[model samples]
Target chain A: SQTIHQWPATLVQPVGSPLSLECTVEGTSNPNLYWYRQAAGRGLQLLFYSVGIGQISSEVPQNLSASRPQDRQFILSSKKLLLSDSGFYLCAWSEASAVYEQYFGPGTRLTVT
Target chain B: AQSVSQHNHHVILSEAASLELGCNYSYGGTVNLFWYVQYPGQHLQLLLKYFSGDPLVKGIKGFEAEFIKSKFSFNLRKPSVQWSDTAEYFCALSTLVNFNKFYFGSGTKLNVKP
Candidate 1:
C-alpha cells in the first residue's frame, strides 16, 4: 500500500518569512504530485503540480512554488510569505501509470501572522 | 476552462433523512468526475468516482451518485443519512488526458443531526 506523509502538520509563520512544506510518498515511484490550498469555507485551489523531477506546472499565480527533487519527494516553498498565504496546505499523489485517482495527505495548517 | 459547481453550500438534516447533493461540471469533452468527503479535522477521502460504464456509481457508507451525461451532472444520493455521515463533500472534475489536475467545487457541508 502507498502512504503519503506531510510534515510540520501545523505551522505558524511571520510575514515575509520563508516557508517550506515537505511531502513524501512511500511505496510509489514517479507519481504525480500536487499542491493545493484550502481557505476557510472555500474550495481547494490548485497551486502546483509536478509530473517528474524538475517539472512543475503551476495552476495559479501566487506566492508559492513547488519542486519535485526526487521521484517521491515534493516540496512547497516560498521565499517570502504573505498574509493571504495562510491556509490549509494539502499534498496529494496519484500513480503515474495512468493512475488518476488522487490520495491526499493529512495536510499542513499554516497561519501567517 | 474546466470547472465544477456544487449548489448547496450547507445542508442540515435529521438522522435517517435522505440526501441529494447536486454537482455539475462545465466540460464538453471527455472527462472524469469524483466526489470526496472530508470529515472535520481529517484528510479528504474518495467517496466515489465515475470513469465510465455505470451511470449510477455506489460508494462506501451507503452513498451513491448518478452520472447524467446529458445534464453534465453527477448528483450524490443517500437513502438514509446518519450523524456520522456529517461531513463536507466536494465534487471534482478532471480532463481524461490531464487527470492529475483536478478542479474542485466550492463543496457542500452536510450536518446530520442525531
Candidate 2:
C-alpha cells in the first residue's frame, strides 16, 4: 500500500520567515503530487501540483511555491511567509494512471505569528 | 471555468436517519465526480466517485452517491448514518484529460447525533 508522509505535523513560524514543508510518498513511483491549503472553517485552495520531476503547476498565485526534486519527493517552500499563510497545508498523491482519486497525508498545521 | 457547489453548509441528524447531501457542478463536458469525507483531525478520504458507466457509485463506510447528468448533480446518500459519520464532506469534479486538476466545493459539515 502507498503512504504519504508530511512534516512537521505542526509548525509555528514568525512573520517574514522562510517556510519549507516536505512531502514524500512511499510504495509508488511517478505519482502526481499536489499541495492544498485550508483556512479555518473554509474550503481548501489548491496551491500547486507536480506531474513529474522538475514540473510544477501553480493553481493560484500566492506566496508559496512547489518543487518535485525526486519522483516521490515534493516540497512546498516560500522565501518569506505572510500572516495570511497560516493554515492547514495538505499534501496529496495519486497514481499517474489514476490521478482522479488522490490520497492525502496527515497534513501540516502552520501558525504564523 | 469549472466549479462545484455543495448546497448544505451544515446539517444535523440523528443516528439511523437517512443522509442526503446535495452536490452540483457547472461544467458541460466529460467530467468525473467524487465525494470526499474529512473526519475531525484527519485527512480527506474518498467516500465515493463517479467516472463513467454506472450513474450510481458505492463507496466506503456504507455510503453511496447517484449522478444525474441532466441535473448536473451528484448527491450522497446513506440509509443509516451513525454518530461516527459526523464530518465535513466535500464534492469534487475533474476533467477527463486533466485529471490532476480537481475543483472542489465549499464542503458541507454533517453532524449525526446518537
Candidate 3:
C-alpha cells in the first residue's frame, strides 16, 4: 500500500521567516503531487501541483512555491512568510495513470505569528 | 467563474437522523465529482466519487451520493447518522480539460450529536 508522509506535523514560524514543508510518498513513483491550503470555513485552495520532476503548475498566485526534486519527494517553500500564510497545508498524491482520486497526508499546521 | 457550491455551511443533527448534503457545480463539459470527509484532527479521506456509470454512488461509512447531470448536482445522503460521523464534508470537481486541478466548495460541517 502507498503511504504519504508530511512534516513537521505542526509548525510555528515568525513573519518574514523562511518556510519549508516536505512531503514524500512511499510505494509510488511518478505520482501527481499537489499542495493545498485549507481554511476554517473555506474549502481547500490549490496552491501548486507537480506533474513531474522540475515541472510545477501553480493554481493561484501567493507567497508559496512548490518543487518536486525527486519522483516521490515534493517540497513547499517560501522565502518570506506572511500572516495570511497561516493555515493547514495539505499534501496529496494521485496515481499518474488515474489522477482523479487523491490521497492526502497527515498535513502540516503552520502558524505564522 | 466556474465553481463548486455547498449550500450548507454548518449542520447539527442527532444520531439516527438522516443526512442530505447538497453539492452543485457550475462547469460544463466532461467533469468528475468527488466527496471527501475530514474527521476531527485527521486528513481528508475520499468518501465517494462519480466518474461515470451509476448515477448513485456508495462510499465508505454507509454514506452515498447521487449525481444528477441535468441539475449539475451531486448530493450526499446517509440513511442514519452516528456521532462518529461528525466531520467536515467537502465536494470537489475536476475535468479532463483542466489536468489535475480540482475546484472545491466551501464545505459543509456536520455535527452529529449523541
Top candidate, metric lDDT: 3
Docking class of 2: medium
- Docking quality (DockQ) for each candidate: 0.76, 0.68, 0.81
For model 2, the superposed segments whose C-alpha errors exceed 4 Å read none
Q: Which regions of candidate 1 deviate over 4 angstroms?
A: none
Ranking by lDDT: 3, 1, 2
* lDDT digits (tens) for residues A1-113 of candidate 3: 99999999999999999999999999988999999999988999999999899999988889999999899999999999999999999999998887769999999999999
lDDT of 2 by residue, B1-114 (tens): 899998799999999999999999999899999999999988899998999999999999999999999999999999999999999999999997678988889899999999
Number of residue pairs clashing in candidate 3, backbone atoms closer than 3 angstroms, sequence gap of 3 or more or interchain: 0
For this target, which candidate reaches the highest DockQ against the unseen true structure?
3
**What lDDT tens digits, residue by residue, belong to model 3 across residues B4-114?**
999999999999999999999998898899999999988899999999999999999999999999999999999999999999999999998875988899999999999
Worst 10 residues of 1 chain A by lDDT: A93-102
Query: Could you tell me which residue pairs clash in candidate 2?
Result: none
lDDT of each: 0.93, 0.92, 0.94
Put down candidate 1 lDDT per residue, B1-114, tens digits, no spaces.
888999899999999999999999999898888999999988899999989998999999999999999999999999999999999999998887678889999899999999
What would the TM-score be for candidate 2 when compared with the true structure? 0.97
DockQ of the two-chain complex in candidate 3: 0.81
